[model samples]
Target: MWSSKYSEDIKEKVLEMYLHGEANVEKISKRYGIPASTIKNWISLYWEEEQARAERSKAASRRKRRFVNGKELRVVRPTSGSAYIDWRRK
Candidate 1:
């Protein structure tokens, strides 16, 4: 694709502008002399990449929460006992 011919830096800026409603594909294409389809492709690619990143981040946070909440680490000491072995719940 013609868009692939451009450098990563250029494509990233184009994607940012498109995402923020600062510019549409046609406007950016005309301004940069790139193809409109290329701009559209860049925008699509950017959104897909961002969605995947968000999903991964959400999964990581869920795992951390489960690990922290599911484990019981508190320790309780046993009280004094007589001749017979006995256990009591506090």
Candidate 2:
């Protein structure tokens, strides 16, 4: 059975190998005995297509509505882990 947890270093190494064209996920999975699905997940998480990357950048500046303390507020939360709420925006 494969270990349930793998270190970040190991993941980085695998990602690098894949990105560098050393091998595709199936080959890497077989070589390292890891599941191909797991490697694919890492690729999706780490590698964004250009359109997706741009969309993500746009979303960072977008404001979404949320209810906080019985008030509908527009919250602009960037990917930077900070949030600001505009109560008057609604």
RMSD of each: 14.5, 9.0
Candidate 2 C-alpha lDDT tens digits along 1-90: 123497787788899999999999999999888899998987877756646888988996685657777778766677688999767533
TM-score of each: 0.63, 0.50
Give candidate 1's error at residue 90 in angstroms. Answer: 26
- Alpha-carbon lDDT, every model: 0.71, 0.79
Clashing pairs in 1: none
Clashes of 2: 0
Looking at model 1, residue 23 earns an lDDT score of: 89
Output the TM-score of candidate 2. Answer: 0.50
Scored by lDDT, the top model is 2
